[model samples]
Target chain A: MKGMTIIVQTITRLVKIFILLYGLYLTLTGHLTPGGGFAGGVVIACLYILLTLAYGRQWALRRFPRRLAGSLDSVGGFIFLIVACLGFGFGGMFFVNFLERFFPGRPFALLSAGTIPLNNIAICLKVAASLFLVFIVMAGARLLEKKDRTYDYKQEEEE
Target chain B: MIQLLPLFVAIPLGAAFLTALAAFKARRLADVGSALATGALLVLAVITIGRQGVYPVGGFLAPLGITLVLDGFSVLLLLIVNGIGFLATLYSISYMERYTSKYKYFTLFLLMIGGMNGVVITGDVFNLFVFLEIASIASYALVAFGGEHEELEASFKYLVLGSVGSGFILLAIALVYGATGQLNMAGIAMALAGTDKHLLIAFASVLFLAGFSVKAALVPFHPWLPDAHPSAPAPISAMLSGVLIKALGVYALARIIFNVLGATPLFGMIVMGLGVLSMTVGVILAVGQWDFKRLLAYHSISQMGYVVLGIGLGMFILASGGDSVVAGTALLGGILHLANHAAFKSLLFFCAGSVEFRTGTRMLKELGGIQEKMPVTRLTCTVASLSIAGIPPLNGFWSKLIIVIATIQAAFTYPGLLVLTAVTVLVSFVTLVSFLKVLRYVFLGALPDAFRKIKESPFFMGVTIVSLALLCAGMGLLLVPAARGAILDPAIEALKQGLGYGSRVLAGM
Candidate 1:
């Protein structure tokens, strides 16, 4: 797929960093605010989608490959499940808030709620990677279909 | 045993992702990891047969924190889900070779297992819905795994209808919460006990029935199962018909209605009506089908009707203040038939899959006697067929007999029940006739020239299916009082308590 116009590309290049930063901000401060991992993850995915739109598919894929995104998706899920299983170590319960129970992060701070922040971060990685992957795969299919149609039209004209 | 309740969900989920991550390097890891995970679950379910516990997740008490209940009811369901899950995984090792992306298949399979486990063990209403979606979404993906035009179309139909069902369930949960201010099943039971929100409760009850009926594929809501079950791979077909429908649809509805809302005559009547309709309609549809998998799928609907009928009869009896013994008898029949159906139906699907695996076709018209070549499959398929037809000395006959006897016992109290007994017998006869057709066409006819070169399925698939056939034969031994007290009775007791379940759970905690 080809890149967009120079004007659009320039704006996306300028705006991408800020959007990524905002996504991180949302994820890290999820416990203190309304936005959490899922919200932040979507925002981050949007930034990559913007990059894909502004630059070409090849450029975007070179920066963040499908293999890397897929692995990251699994990694995020592992982190989440491991966090839940870790609760079994601190307490017999499957998802007990063991950190808050013993370590007791300060209230109204970034580390409060013990495992909730970690969970949010894990969820953020998962959502962002999965969403980006979904976008690219779907776009690839659409592009393939379009190519097939054009090739068929060329054949018809030749006939 | 109670403390480890979460592992039922955890183990399968962890294996799913683990399979995905590792299979990128070693393509075979998906097979071993998934089988080990489901095997672990089956072992866990086995050891916890008679045990019951209320686990408060995050160490929060009930009515406040999410609870996982491992009562007799859920334990039985856990056994069926993970037990069949282990076998399905084993079967898929050889069976899934025709499909690419083996890891993706295992991943979705494990996710479906985890989701079904969660649905069974959860005591919270909203949590049930979440797990229901998890299982449903995984299944929808698996149905379309083939990526063919027909597969995709069937999957789309399944998805749209499934989402509508989920919407109704969510709306009902909201209504119940609004009325009782409780999301926990027991808490709802307690809060709703004395309340006069009759209309609200009635409306919510109807919504739950409609939603769960759709999931269970009760007649009016059953259009998707025929398409979705057949289009998927054979192992997946077994799972969908064998345990998935029972866990997500019948078991979920049974839990919510009898335990949370308590049994009422009207609820009983409506459920039984749906059951009877599904029975007749499903078999009637099956009688005309030529596709092997499609025929079994229709039989699944019909057999599920038998289960629902028994349970509904129990609910009706208890609600109307009838004899306790009759209610227990009816319930025993229903729940036992569920387990029996799980074994035989999955075995039947496996046999059909084996036929397709060897012959490269599933249509009855395209299949004929290869029985001499595929002796093990022919034998196991015959066993499963007889068991499903309610022939003597097998599990199916015992449960059907119990249901018929219970109906007769109840008929003295309400003469209308005899009519039900007649219908039950008639449906059983129809089931036999259809199986006879399957046997006559596929196994007894002259060997088709096309299948002369065909052979028995792989050793693993044969072993997996034979184990299920063994279960179909030996499950009748569960009727012995000592064994019954351990597994089946507790499940029956769990439902028998009805609204009293609230106090029992809270006190147990």
Candidate 2:
């Protein structure tokens, strides 16, 4: 219930940053490539899940606490909404590509698609936080506690 | 004004997160922010009356990009969903103080409201499914918010059945996409219009009907509703029964059948059949229930039957080339009943919630004589009870009368339809009897010694219930010529247009 062996912890410490970096890369380049916010976010969340498995709840919570994760999720959702609503202030309707004329960057570049890359970033933040929250909520319980697994049923009898 | 259409969905969604973040610091922000958000949406919906337009999301033209349409049907539903939503949020201001995690509750509540708005306005069928899931998932979580054994069990049942329904809906969407190669509603209608009635389309239609039946809690797919509705927090119970079922289930069904697939005589008959079954069966089961909320939940099923029957009769008449005036009358009755039910049903649930809040019990057998203590609740509950029982001059009466008259008129052309007239009356009478039981058991009779100290519900709760009660008493004005022209008639006309909706939408684009 504490954690894994030192070897697994050492390996996770080395690989976690790279995995997070790769997820960010995928999200930033999503407009031009296949792996977008959702896929990239899941990949980023996997890094934390790996940390939890290797180093236990104490170490993982130290890095990404519950409140931080919750805030990140809300912030991401709000940012996405603001970006969508931003188009309304311009000449075009809601969610319009008002940035297209200003940016007008080269095609297929990282910043070529107006508002898409920003949206992808927002979604990446949201999806990553949400996946981590789900894992934490599930694993906060004693995963190996056979008693905890049957906890819900026992409560039913009490009712 | 058309440009503001997307704000209907975006505002609440944005506020959901804002509340989530802000409430972590202040806590009170959640209450103020949610009420303001829903109140803004209500104002927006009112402004939309008698006006119609479409806004393509991201400025992408229809058939290529997602569009938000604000036609009469969408407007009607927006009013019901947002109007009740605002009241529910206000009621929750006082009601939710007893419950922990108030911020989280408001967050999910706003999300549900946003999702329902998105479902109403979206012009694409696939987009409809996505918003439906959003609303459904939010509801599933809210149902289990209490985390009690009963709440968890009810939530699990709802989640499982709801997921199956969503799966069916997704499969049907795939079939429709494969058949028509169109994701937008107008495009799909146009494609389906030219093609013959193929087995693939019929299969998809069947899937849609079955799926929406689950969402609407129709007879065969209704097992989850009774358990889920009563177990949630009372404001949520009001939301679920009042607007969620109508928005996600019946409205979606009507849009698909009338606008996209175009209702044929056979489909109309099948819809009418389902309506009759729910009406008879829902009341029959409801009559035997002692739980106050459960009885109301069953009555939800039964009242939905009236709405569906009215619309279905109109659809049948339209498809069968019967009198156009009669068809319009039937559709009017159905759509009007839909609005009336939203006000009165939520009011009833609010009353139940207030009673439960004060006395800590919803068991009809144990409670009594609280009417002397909570006069506001007693008065509002009586108004709602009268409305639902189809008392004249109240809103429910006018709609029920229109439906009955339509059924009798249709009987001249089709004799079997006469039976539905009698059935509708019988169902109304049975409903009156059920409410009479609720009144006698909960508000009347000797006062239990345990409840003598209870007070009237808090101010916010009383304001909500009273406003809704006033709406219940005054909503018959919607039938007046001036109001009907602006509100009910437009929606009825939209449904009556049927497959022609495709061309109109295309023209708007």
Candidate 3:
């Protein structure tokens, strides 16, 4: 499929960075704010999805390959686990906010809430990557189906 | 000890993700990583056997943050889940070689394990639902891993039904939350204590029964099992049939009915009635199947009935103010059978997998004389078949015997229970007959032309099947006095305490 209209593409190019930055802000400030990893992650995922729609699959694949997104998904989940396991090294229980002991920042701040903000960031990474992977795979399946149908049509014509 | 609780869920989650990340670079990372992760889990399960404690996640206390409980009941389930999970992972190292993308397979496998562990350890009802969804989704994907027409069909069926079950569970949890304003199990039970018979609680209870019965593959709700179990890779079939249903379905149902909702004689009768239905109908249907894995799947439903019957009987006795000894004996039989089935049923599935791996078919009529070619698989299959058939000295025999004796003793008091006792024995006899058909058709007949050159399964597969077979042989020893004291008694005591669990957990915290 070709790209969308030039106007749509131009607007997406201009607005995509702000959308991504807002998603970043929401994820980083999740512990105190209403929007957390799941909501903000969807927002971030929307940016890429918008890019894919505006520029087509080929353009998106060139910038952010499916393999990289898949790898990032796994790495994000591992980071979350590592943060939880680090609690043991800090002489506390599993999932304990060990960072609170070292840095008891003021409440309602972005850096506060111990390990929670870090966990939010990790989840945002995973959710964003996984959602994109799902989208790509589904789109790829549609393309394959179309190819199969056209190939069958050619074979029938030859027959 | 309490701190070790979260490791059950955390270890596998970490390993799965790391494998997913690193396996792209090093192809062998998935195999080594999952094996090590499950290995650690088995050791952790062993070390925490008799210890009981509560961990409040994030130090937010029980009523607010999630709590992980390591009671005797949870410990028993942990052993079964991790022990079988380790073997399944080990077998997959070799068995999954034929399938592509080993890393993705291992990632999903460990996630399923992590989810099961989370289900058993979590003390909050809503947390249980979350873990249940995680495990269910993973299993659904694993079932369709091969992407064959049959596999996809079965997986879609399972996924739809499983989602409906989850919906019922969520609705029930919402009802309970609305009624009690509590999410922690102990707090819910405390709030539910002595509350007069209310329709809301009854509605929640019925929803729990329907939801969990579907998960457990009980009769009338068991259409998906026969298809889903046979379509997956063999090791996966073993895992699904072995511990997943029991852990997700039976354990959750029993815990809620007995501890949270406070078991009553009426509920006991409903459970027992369902048990008898599955027991009679499952074997009856299993008797006609020629497909190896499909037959085994039907038998899973039958065996689960035995577990539910024994536990249900115990619940009836306890609620009706009958003899505590009899109640203890009955529940012990039920719980013991659960563990015993995990070993033998998984062994049975592994044996079927081995045959399929070498010969490329699971249809009983299409294969013959496998015993001569794959002695290890044949021997393990025989042992597992005998164990399931309740032959003497095998693990299945001891548990079935106890359940039978308990039922007969209950008959002396009620006389109506005599029907259940007779059904138990009759079911055992029919189980033997059906397995005899399997034996004759798959192993004892003359060799087929197509299968003559097939060899035995790989080294790790043989090791896994043999180890599980040995467990099947020796599991009866768990009934010995010393072992019983350490393992079975504590779990039974926890259930018998009923609503008292609320105060004990609260006091412990």
Every model's DockQ, to 2 decimals? 0.50, 0.70, 0.50
Q: List the residue pairs that clash in candidate 3.
A: none
Q: Which stretches of candidate 3 lie over 4 Å from their true place?
A: A102-108, A143-159
Name the better of 1 and 2 by TM-score.
Answer: 2
Q: For candidate 3, lDDT tens digit of each residue in B324-427?
A: 99999899989999999999999999999999999999999998888889999999999999999999899999999999999988888999999998999999
DockQ comparison, 1 vs 2, better candidate: 2
RMSD of each: 3.3, 2.7, 3.2
Between candidates 2 and 3, the one scoring higher on DockQ is 2
What lDDT tens digits, residue by residue, belong to model 2 across residues B1-509? Answer: 88689988998898899988889678899999999999999999999998998788887888889978888899999999999999999999999998888999999999999999999999999999999999999999999999877998999999999999999999999999998899999899888885678788888888999999999999999999999999999999999999999999999999998889878899889989999999999999999999999999999999999999988899999988999999998899899999999999999999999999999999999899999999999999999999999998899999999999999999999999999999999999999999999999999999999998999999999999999999999999998899989988889888888878777888883
Q: Write model 1 residue lDDT over B228-312, tens digit each, in one string.
A: 9999999999999999999999999999999998778988988998999999999999999999999999999999999999999
Model 1 chain B: which ten-residue window has the lowest total lDDT? B190-199
Ranking by DockQ: 2, 1, 3
Error of 1 at A17 (Å): 0.7
